[model samples]
Target: MLTETRRVARIVLLDPDDRVLLLNGFEPRNPATTWWFTPGGGLEGEESREEAALRELAEETGITDVALGPVLWTRVCSFPFDGRRWDQDEWYFLARTTQTATDQRGLTELERRSVAGLRWWTSAELSATRETVYPTRLAELVRTLLDEGPPHVPLVLAPEIV
Candidate 1:
């Protein structure tokens, strides 16, 4: 089968303490190589990036009251998951909230099997930890955005490993 390129919208959910929430999951075929990523999934037909981001944030984390901010960054990533090669173009949005509780009832079957858990990470923790995170320079990007606010234009990020 031909590998299709998927368009995804993700959210960087920040708390009052400046920590960002991330979901931990692994490639189903290779569970040992786990990674953490922001909450998101592929966009549905005709849905705008922001709409997808909002839906995904609610579905993935069950936090729906936060105001979505502008696109902070974008990246193109290719990875293997569920026995398929996925080429995904992802847009990242910034959102802030004080809510800490999350409900995982909306997670898909794949997510339920592959996702290990979630955590809130400070910039320092993101920088110091060896665990893999997508967009590679998440700590630097988060610190910059927290310090200066969102940019006038969304920043382009480098591709990350599979």
Candidate 2:
């Protein structure tokens, strides 16, 4: 089977307390398995990665006033969602905001069904959680970023096998 590569833009939105925002979602084909991931989605036509990241951030969450930083990381992920196999190249941007209020009104039908919850996670929480999280090394990465600051060039994360 030929699998098309999809470009995705994601944001690691940090709150004033350094907690990162994540969405909990599950594959429809296997609802029993769930995972937490940063907010993002496939890019629309002609949109730059940064533009798509900003758009997805506003659409997925409700805070739109945050200033986006540089692309902090990139990762390739392959997984099955719904009934289709997806091979995604994801770019992750960093943004900080104090706002926590979210409006789910903008979510698509698929998102409404697949995304069950959203939460802010401190590094400690992320490390201690038993729940599955994508980009598996999130806590360690975030801690490094927080201590050392964003890199001059985007970091290429190892591909994740789901």
Per-residue lDDT, model 1, residue 138, is: 89
Determine which window of 10 residues in candidate 2 has minimal summed lDDT: 98-107
Query: Which 10 consecutive positions of candidate 1 have the poorest summed lDDT?
Result: 153-162
lDDT of 2 by residue, 64-157 (tens): 8787998999999998789877899999999999898887677888998798879999999998998988889998889998999998999999
Query: What TM-score does prediction 1 earn?
Result: 0.94
lDDT of 1: 0.89
In terms of lDDT, model 2 sits at 0.89
Q: What are the Cα lDDT values of the candidates?
A: 0.89, 0.89
Candidate 2 stretches with Cα past 4 Å from truth are: none
> In model 2, what are the clashing residue pairs, if there are any?
none
